[model samples]
Target chain A: MSEPNTREITYLEAVREALTQEMRRDPSVFLLGEDIGVYGGAFGVTRGMLEEFGPERVRDTPISEAAIAGAATGAALMGMRPVMEIMFMDFITIAMNQLVNQAAKIRFMFGGKASIPMVIRTPAGSGTGAAAQHCQSLEAWFINVPGIKVVAPATPYDAKGLLIAAIRDNNPVLFMEHKLLYRTKGPVPEELYSIPLGQAVVRREGRDATVLAYSVMVPRALEAAEQLSREGIELEVIDLRSLKPLDQATIVASVSKTGRVLIVHEAPRTGGFGGELAAVIAESEAFDYLDAPIRRLAGRDIPIPYNRTLERAAVPQVEDIVAAARALAQEGR
Target chain B: MTEFVPHPILDPAVIPRGSQQLLRELPKERLAWMLQKMCEIRYFEEKAEELYVRGLVHGTMHLSIGQEASSVGSIAALRPDDLIIHHHRGHGHTIAKGADLKRMMAEFLGKECGYCRGRGGSMHIADIPGGNLGATGVVGSGIPTAVGIALALQMRRSPQVLLAFFGDGAVNLGEFHEALNMAAIWKLPVVFICENNQYGMSGPAKVMCAVQPLSVRAIAYNMPGQTVDGNDVLAVYQVTQAAVERARRGEGPAFIENYTYRWRGHSKSDRNVYRTQAEIDEWKQRCPIARFKQLLIEAHVLTPEEVETIDAQAKMAIERAAEEALVCPEPSPENLEAEVYAP
Candidate 1:
């Protein structure tokens, strides 16, 4: 598939197209979850999809996450690649038993005899006023699991490419899409092209402190990196598309050149992806070349509030990353 | 040397002798094969009890001690392409499906040679290549999984049936309700084998279960439900064989409850205080192996001398498996990150 015949679309359209193409390509591919078919998905991401894929492929299931996950696992075992939607990331807790105990362990338990090639596509993050129950960032939860792959794509291009890859991959993948990012637009090729899971893209190149981020924070980090460039302190922003594999090579390369690192993410400071990046940098050969101890700018542990003011305060703003980068640059190791 | 012998014991009230006659009518070789399979399970479980007492196996070990008949009978009916999800007490199901006993025993010991590289111990043994998708420790988790397998089978128009082996306790789990609803609505080819071992942990079937007969719950789902003698291997086999045939013919799922009892505690650490010792002895009197052995003797299929050879063979096979599993190397640390995702 090439970009010549393909047209550019919004992140939402890109995801829809990817799913539609995959469904058409494979008969065994089907969707299952609550309010997805008739309701066109909870966030309307699957709008008009039910008519296209029909009731069989774009299925509307009961409000049971365990049922959805367990069914997906079962289907995968029987040679069907299923794409299951979990409306809210928070609700994944209800189905953790199937995801962790069954989906993750099935293949290994069978000594590689079984493969659960399913994707759990869920909307996450706090920008929307969906509040406490709906807007928590739980990527860290899936990242902790061994058998499943955790992926959160920031751009429309990556969203389409990564999802296609996830469906084709012969393992369970937890695909987390930020709630606020669905409408965001980018140049996604009409032709199919899959982005590998564990690779990182250099969103912006600079020589000062390296800023490693993922998901919604990647765009924000790149924006901050541009603003900080005019202040004479250039920053390198690395977008970590896949969290579990953690694309250590790109982060290590960027940090080695700059000698100072500042990791930014929307997840809370305690035990977040930033901690994982920091640990990797500290343990690697890049540790000896650091000009300053790696600093992390992440969200506070407080619950995301409904109020605009409180919600903004709960997550990492562009100013937070810029400030963290400046402070790290000033304090040399 | 200790002489190996098969002792015939009986209580037809638990398992009727007529079912054994049906088994004999089936291919004689097939009947012999089924009996050998059940014997292997009995020997393995007995060894597990011994190892559990010695503290070699960590975590609670759920024994399929008395319910071997139902496990072997149901699995024997499935084809190579058909899928099965076993319950926590799943050793019999795994072994019946052709899981290598040495590797399986290693899994119980949490050694690297275990199927999951020691990640999942005794409660979650799996070998999906042989159509054994694996078992879950969580009650009723496999119900939806089996439903999903059937759904896929239906989508592919493949004549493959999915089987889920659960205990009577699973009927109480909410997932069971959701799974049954899905299976009924789609009319998927799934066989729900409920080994009604009379108790969930220490709670008796009569006290904990609100429903009189657990199989009756299937009727509400618009599926056929039946109750069979779980202690009688042949009886379980006959009913389940019919159910499997129905599923393969696309007649939809069937709920079959096999009434049976476990001869030991729920797990090794269970203090036998919840039930009286007399109750335990009563169920022990209806042991599946004893009843089946008596049928073989009465029918002249196996003589006292021939049965003695079978017992010796079973013990030797189990002992060999134990030795091989004991010496097998643990999974290398590098392999820990290997199977998480396909490369």
Candidate 2:
């Protein structure tokens, strides 16, 4: 609830600002993770925070994902809002029990006696050429869980706003930051503000087909829609900022208008979140309005290759989205 | 060591020299309360076992029947405001941390008035308001969470300590080492107590363990570690007392391995193929409740008559709780999705 900064900043800077502002606004909010202190995090998302907040608030911890996640869960139970950076989303595998079983289920298991007010921030996606070990989109794992919330912000504006919202949310939240989206600059208000979770923002409105996306895929969907607009084909692109408390109303309304759907994500297709989105449409009133079968454009079911060329082919690209959107848009015509 | 069997009785020489005199100097009322709580836990699980065998309770449960001293003594050392996190076999931890007996039984019976509103059964019952954060079905899950609570307390500069309870099985988990190492480095105010009942399911810790005592792993973290006769209530209390006080003083975490035994099989589904009935019978002869009763009588903290009266009261209390829990309304399916996330 403060004034926003008028200047433009990168998505990574926006995330740091949110952490800085939240820690400043509330004493209970703190940051902890490996290399977050002096090293400024593995990707520099928390660079200047250590100097400003000191070691106590900006804790540099051992590389223990389980402890990092479990510590956040415990601290949240004690009424402290802790933000833990997992360095890479792929490393979250080591901490899944704490993330899925303990942190996610604590509130419900305790009958609402406690709420785990914690955030797990990890840089995700396949563009970094960091290979299968570091580059992968696993947001679907957190979304599959019942108690935790998942936030995948697309722009600098959403990155800051959703991070603030996630910190204030009285539940475990997994915040996915695409490695490529970090440097993309956009207008962000410097003052304290929050974007409510589960609210979808329609980046582009169209009548031909609806493009559902999140995280890094949102921008690609927007660019794909931009490319097709010249051919009189307009694609509606909806960025699902929050995954668990899904904005089904927005998704349904978009699909109802367009009568076609194209779900895109960086994760492999076999059991990715696209399947859940497709099921949501098929099971809802949106199914009645469908003009064509829903199409899913996702990563192939294989380990991400370290080779730059194969990595690009392993996940969806702007070209991939353009082709997928073009096909879905012209299917019924 | 390959054959799983514990000494039928405890060695009196293993008791710490000044601990009994420390017991004399301690509050008599607290000792009496611990005795009563231990009895209540024993009877509570016995009743729960009876129900599960009768097809009344839902799902399988892990019983800490032979490990009551480890729960009661460690919890007894904490201040009322201090927090705790329990492992799956945690009825004793919940009860010792001052949960409502009737409500606990209601949870076991899957009633709406239960702790988790029947959403969580035996392995997940919690009493958060009363300082028990709850338990998870997974082994060693609570270790890091307990350290996290300690980190919170450290940030707030709170004197409150977190007493984390787990089993011998949990000591082998990756999270255990990670959590302990972090706790030591941060000097977080927490006490990690391992209820080493010797088996993780059918696999005996004696065969699986690389170290003699589970607490020895704490040395890797450069934290204090101790192994105590968990059957001796006073001994558990003594070791936990030092660790709790050390944590309150911000000296960092301590690990205490309570060498106890679980008289029952791991759970209802266990067929007892791993251990013999002779071993079970041996542990039964060294029941924590009976040992505590003898300790109290000799120390004058409680008389033989007083111990029996407490035992009777505890048994009656458990029975009354069971009766009330059995008739409580079943939880409605409506609003089942409400608690999945906080509003």
Candidate 3:
């Protein structure tokens, strides 16, 4: 099958397109999870899949996340690349044993004779006001586990490319899709391409301060960077596409050039992805280029409340990111 | 229909001679092989207990003291290509799946010659090439992995079956129930073997399970379930043979509850504060080893002299394996980070 010519689509469409393309390419590839078929998906990412391939290939499993994950892991080990659609990112906690214990460690425990080439796609981040249970940015949980690759794509280009790459990779990959960015559009190439799992992309170039962000935070950081540009604060923005195998080189390069760094994420400030980025910079040669202690603008440690105002307050808004960037830019080395 | 009595089926004195025809059917050579494997497992675990007490085995040890029949007999029914995922009390399964004794001993010693290259000690040893995927310290975790392997075999059009072994405690876990349900629904070629050794480390199976028989739970998943004499090697072997054949023939997964008892505590450090000594004595009387030896004697397959010779040979083999493992070099500190992930 030839690649689709649509260059611009929603993040959800990009994900659906990736699944469609991969399923067509490999007979062993299948999708299973709640509401992934007939109903399209909880987020409608798998809409029309049932019509295209039917339920055998695009299966709608029970509400048991553990079973869904275990089934995917089993299927993956049996020479199938199962792409599982977790309805909500928070529900991933229910399947941690299979994801963290079984899927991630099987290959290594079996001395590399086996591999779980499975991908778990879930909608993550707060902002939709789905509350604490449904909306969460739990990519950090997966980052700590070995043998599995974790990717949080912020753009349609990345969403499609990385999904394709994950399906093809020889290890388990957790693909966390931002719930807020599913409808957001970006230019994705028509040719079949893949963004490597551990590589980071420079979203913007600047010289004053390096703004590192991931998933939904990338767009917020980009919006803040646009406003900061007018104030003569050239903010360099980095999209950490893959959290597990973090692209430390890109982060260090930008920090080295700008001499200032500010990390931003939707997860809570304490023990969040920002802490990892901060530690990486502090431990790397880029620490010498610091103009001030690295600042982290992140969500407050609390359940994502139901109210819109509280939800917005819990996460780092654009203004909050802008203020943090200004503070890093003005500080002395 | 004959009414089933709730008793350890390995008690040859109670079981009618006709009921034990399966145990006597094995030829002399096969009986000797089964006896050798049971002795290997028993002696290996006995040695492991000694090493653990002396603080030589680094991690916790889940020894298979009195439940050798489940692994030895059940695994004997599987082909070399068939896969098995063992539990923490998995040395029997590993050896039954054909893991090398030298490497198996070295693994407990954390030597470079260990099957996991010293990364995984007793509880986590894995030999994938030999068809033993690995043993999990976490209960019920291997059930899903085995189901997945069976699913893989079905996809590849292979007739190989997957034998997933877990303990009585694991059956209460959601993963166990979920994996079994999925395998049943998909008609996946897998056998769910529950080594019901009376207790899950102080928690007796009777208290955890509402129904007396664990095999009855399989009907809920719409699959064939059976209860076998876990202590009797022949009964365990016959039931497992039927399950494996059913799976290979695309008849779907089967549930098996092997009724047995563990003579050791849950782990090495366990002091028997949970149960009474009288109960242990009661189970020890029905030990599968003694029952098998008696049956072999009555069948004229082995005399007293040969039984002693076999015991001596088993002891010698253990001494040689232990000596080699003790002298084997400990894994280099530089190799500590190895095998964490595939490069």
Candidate 4:
């Protein structure tokens, strides 16, 4: 239950509130991105922040993603908590060296003498008809690299708290925000609160089967679980909040009790994060309790198409999760 | 335009100076210290080569044996607290910024007592407390990194300046232009120094770059640019000192191209197939340390005896550092991932 004064706000607003509160509380917190200052960010998450913080704090940089990312790494070394925004997660491919090689490895390369207190906030996943170049969920790309924290918040509340935690985190963090979730409203407190990184929240509890989801997939899993409960087939929907330093224990417990699991995401399934999750579960003690072959419900191994119907078919819909979970629950009994 | 002057310092006019004003104004001890640091880098690099040849050191090393004067002279202009973030070929820059010879050597030897606890080897030595922010082996990566640190300092309203060092080939990198524009537009306190070592690895920078005297790229970014004879310690000192003051005063960033050469190959794996032997011998005749030693003796800044004593002390210092580093314990395997994330 949210406390009093906890008004319903969109995921975008929660992110802005977290940033606004942090900047007011600390002098070092600042924002940087293309057209972020005057244009108020591509998604309007930082709208009106420019007027409040002034030009020095809310900087609009050139369209060079490499420079923007590298500059964030540098500023973080000197004790500035920089929150840099990339226009789209797809464009982050151009800035991979800076993010993966430099920002992620700078601390360990310097033997931990350096603290990169920075965040790379970008809009990830697809549904806006932005097509292939603009729509992609690139969290798996970042999770592969060590020394950087990765967060994908499903609810407005988690978005605010997790972003605050990322900003306060002394290491580099990649904050992946789904484009479609910006308008999704949920109860969020007006006061500032931070959620610790690497903690998973079980959105729904059931014993029939386990559904592992994150970011935009969590809400879909919940809808699917609600449908499955009508047929007396209940699913425990878990939101894996932090991708790196993953909350493996929570996943193991749910899998051990349920005896079946379904990992879901919107990214292509060929080399997706679901593979990593499956390996983690298979290697853990949860493997002994599994009653069925593990199943994965993820995006097709193709780019997110421009057509609305094809796009919907590319990733898992609520019905897809319901069907996948239903199949897992009935098998190996 | 008629001919590409590979070593521009051989020409008197190409030095780009009215006079040796800094050499005249600097105290006797400061001048001696500059020369002393240059020698120390020379001896240290030579000892590193000796260790590499004897199989004590693994991995390739980018030895800055010929560019010591460029490093020593420019770093001498900054205060102890000022910062520096540099590129791959960074041994001279690290030592000139006051790296403990023993700790640096231990790092080279992959010992636990090393600066990075044996995590980062030769190309990534960092002395954080001494203002050496660290170096990356990635080409041209330090450009925006230096600007970032400078931006942080600017936001804090601090007067500390940063010196960014890269090679001649870094001029062609997109990060160079992007970072320069950011530093210029933000008016960041950064002094960009490009050690034009004539070649980047085996690729001739002349063929790689469309621009001669890469500092001219600074014009596009609206920053002041100058090229100096990197071998002339006094000339490099004069140029960097002015740029450091301009940055400290918040006048914005400056681009300085120090025309020098690397006596050794790019790294230990270099086959020496790109450049001619005669060209290498000719540049060796223009050795920065030897030239600086002659200048100091002729300028009466130090007697011949004093210069020899400094050289002898440097050699002995390197000897002592290697001796200490040879016996240091290796980093334990259990603690490999302990430093991946900060506490």
Candidate 5:
């Protein structure tokens, strides 16, 4: 077949297209969340879906996160693919028992007789002035869970593809989206397509140093790589779309070739997903090729502040990634 | 707000308890089967307790000894195709729902022949084909799940109903209220059955709940709510039947709080520190099995000899199951990682 036609679309539009296309393709797939029906969701990611699929398919649930999560799990157990949205990542704490204890453990605890085919889509990271309660990156919490697969997409292309993969996968998936990436547009295919869950994408190719990033940090890492390229310091940017089933091969290959690594994320530095990536690289054969100590540039170990300056300071900016990669590349010399 | 008056349907002192008129109308064979099932549950729990004490069973097991009527009656009210979501103390509920006796025993014994392949011992037993969605160890965690199941059923316009069984402790959980309100607003075909066994672990219900009747809380969700004498099998059966019918008719969810008592302490570790012996004796005197048996005999539905024969048959079945479970092989570690996800 000829190459599929493509067009530019925002990350939010891509997410909606994926949901609409998947629901039309599969009758069992449905969406549920607080203000998802007529309200089109908190971030308008599910706009027009209610009218397209009607109220049954686009369920507007009560302001009960536990019920949304638990109900999705239950529906999944009963052979329905439910895509639930938790308006903000911070509110996920309320439904932790259902997602972590029940949904994550059901298949293993039930002797594998049941498979929970469900996806929880939520907006994460600190950029919007939503403050401490709303602005937080909590993907690290679910990455540690065994049965659940965590996916964080940076661009519209990956967002649509990865979400389709998540909806179709026979496992509970945590799909984390960056609030700032909603309006960001990218070239996306007109037709439906899916990117494999665990495969990492090489956004930019380089050999001087490797920068591992995901979600919002991906664009930032790419920006840093551009600036670093002018200074004659090349940085390979690897976007880990899937966290649980980590693309260790790509990570190892990049780290080995570059001989230096810098892990970046919008989450806190301590106990963040960056630490896990660092450990993975260190444990692999890539450790022997390390020219400098594996560095992790991440958000500070504090709640995201409301002030834009402080919020920017709390998380790693493009400049921070550039500086960290430049210093790591220089250390190799 | 309505006053917290105990539902008259649940009053123990109500006249015509286990109504002979109702018993007279029921088929003799059906009555015999119900009595037999209740006896089997009682005998199975007794044997399980013995096995636990003898160190044959590994983990702590929750026994539904005196609450057999509540388990049997509510389950008996549903069609075989109907679904049930159970709480931690759901062994009797499983048995009442017609789970294989040998497999259940093997599961408790951690044998490969168990329903969950020895993974989910007692608290997490499930029989999917048999319509038992399994039991949860977490209190009230399964309530919202049941609502979701009901929603799916409603969406498909299936004639089936889902019953979510939890204890009085679960009613106090936020999930319970959320699920009830959702089920009520959506008009999902579900029945929320609260087997109020008077205590939650070591805490008494009086101390935990603000309302006298837990069913009263259902009124806040705009659903029909009632309390029933849990020890009266017929009462529990009739109330559950009404709720099940209402759900089947698409009239929305209904809540039934069965007032019952557990004869044993919570799990194998309890020493009965929170309860008095006199209280236990008083509740035991209201034994559901004995009450049902007396009702059957007084109504001439079962002769004393037939009742003895049924008891003997149930005991024999339990013995055979225990023997089969004892000989079943332990799960091999070769495929330990299997079933963590769908293949």
Candidate 6:
């Protein structure tokens, strides 16, 4: 029972539309980051925002990532909703003190007297051969932090809706956008809407196995599921829009029906969000339904290489996901 | 070997111009009030130190013993609505911004009635309704936050300004430079006050910073900078007043380096092995409270008996606050998980 006014738009367009609509709707919301104003962001997600909102609201900051995160936190404490861009997700290490220590801990440390209502939007995942320093999927790092909400939107619809929800939330949210999904088009409604955080969507329901993924992995999982259907293997693909406050009920239900799970992500296999996902499934009622070990098709332990062939080899592609799912399905008869 | 030559701009004795003019123009009540507030801070810290010695206070505490004038004078120049963010040594800043003594004491005592409900003890005391954004234990962590608040003020076109208080130790921090540059370029309404207390824990300012006057770094950000005699209450007040006015007028951020001293070790665990007793004694002679008291007496702002009464009253107030705080209950375990996020 949704509206029928849907149009095809790229993921980047959806993100830009969400920012424009939120900034227009609320006076308390503003954007700040390096090269965001005149440069329109490194990826041009903020292009034309400077002309629409002017330089005061659309601020261009120095190349200091710490200041970008810290300033957004301070502004949020003063009752303004700030959406800051970190340029690249890997550079978040420079601003870790502000994001992890200050922004994440302020509200709790202050006994809830302060609310850091802010959003940090950064491009994540490995693709485009940006190398190790520029390309990374750091959502797991933020998901482990107690006081912050982590969101990784896969499609144009989730990107737009989740970005709006992140801006409206009363807690600090880390919105991770994949680098390669910027231009991918999907059917998106042209109205301002918010997809609630901590919800999962059943992209492709199946009975054989469940493929759990987020961000760019969702599309790849769907692609793998489609190809596996022709091979008589039915895979259920669930897109986890939010990492923290995870939609465990959906994941558990899918795993209970399929009796197997194949977790996929672009971050390294060691200590990635897939580990948390596997742990959540293992610790839940779905553990008894598992026929095989919860396999994770994730990026290799090595840093993302710059060469196209090695970069492609680092993270799981659609064929890798299909192969992993096929092997998991065939395990134990 | 090069002789230990002091830079001309870092000279601690160089007073600002129009000090006498500032003192003459100020009302007697205002001068007395400044003096009384400084006394309150001194007495509060003395009580806190006594409590720490008695094992009544937990955690490490940083005392701004000799920098009271720098905190009180600069805060006195701002409107009550203006915001402030302080560093770890922020008890004086909190009291100067008019936080209740009982709550502040309770915070140190780790009682539930404290400002942070006993969560943020000495280092993170805050009074949001009173416009104190809160203090941070991380060095130079609060600088960018001040810029952010100033940016919010500018975007909203609010008439309020923000004052960011940090130590000389924070000058070398990357965020400090980044924040100043952002504030300068955006012309945000903020005043960065560096309480140059001569030492960053054990490291001297001269060793930490290569520049002569720390305020001169403001030139890199294209903002006005000044160094004032921090012990002189009138001089600090005047310099801070001009900066606050410039911010209010939308001229941009200004940096003020108040050259002061810390009469005690950096923290409770410090052994004072970094400097000599003679050096400590030299800085002690320039005690902000004593100098401000002498100024008030000379200006006929308060009689010697009135000064004595103010001192006695501050002592009594601190004593009462400490006594009351000792009886407050600890936070309940039933609500241990509360307040992690907004309701």
Model 5 regions more than 4 Å off: A1-4, B1-18
Residue B217 lDDT in candidate 5: 87
What local lDDT score does residue A67 receive in model 5, on the 0 to 100 scale? 89
TM-score of each: 0.90, 0.96, 0.93, 0.97, 0.97, 0.96
Worst 10 residues of 4 chain A by lDDT: A93-102
Per-residue lDDT of B1-343 in model 4, one digit per residue for the tens? 5664343222243345533555577898998888889988999999999999999997778999889889998899899999999877898999899999999999998888888878888988998899999998898888878878999999999989999999997888888888899899999999999999999888887888887777767778877788888988888888888889888998999999999988889999887899989999999999988988888788787899999999999989999999999899998878667778876
DockQ of candidate model 3: 0.52
Q: Estimate the TM-score for candidate 2.
A: 0.96
Which residue pairs show backbone clashes in model 4?
Answer: none
CAPRI accuracy category, model 6: medium
Give per-residue CA lDDT, model 6, range A68-111, as digits (tens). 98889988998999999999999999999898889988987776
Per-residue lDDT of model 1, residues A16-96, tens digit only: 888998988888888998899989998888888899988888988888888888889889877789999999999999888
Per-residue CA lDDT of candidate 5, range A1-333, in tens? 235588889999999999999999999999999999988999999989998999999999999989888889989999999999999999999899899988998887777788899999999989988899999899888988888999999999999999999999999999998999999999999798999989998889999999999999999999999999999988999999988789999999999999999999888888998888999999999999988999999999999999989888999999999888888999847
CA shift of A43, model 1, Å: 2.1
- DockQ-based class of model 1: acceptable
True contacts kept of each: 0.64, 0.83, 0.48, 0.66, 0.64, 0.72
Measured with C-alpha atoms, the lDDT of residue B60 in candidate 3 is 78
Which has the better lDDT: candidate 1, or candidate 2? 2
Taken over the whole model, the C-alpha lDDT of each candidate is 0.84, 0.90, 0.85, 0.90, 0.90, 0.90
- By DockQ rank, best first, the candidates go 2, 4, 6, 5, 3, 1
Q: What is the C-alpha RMSD of each candidate to the true structure, in Å?
A: 6.4, 3.5, 3.7, 2.6, 2.2, 2.7
| Residue-level error in angstroms, candidate 4, position A186 | 0.7
DockQ result, candidate 5: 0.75
lDDT string, candidate 1, B200-314, tens digits: 9888888988775778777678777777889888888777777887888888888889898887788877887788889888988988877877877788777877776777787
DockQ, computed on Cα atoms, for candidate 1: 0.48
Model 2 scores a C-alpha lDDT of 0.90
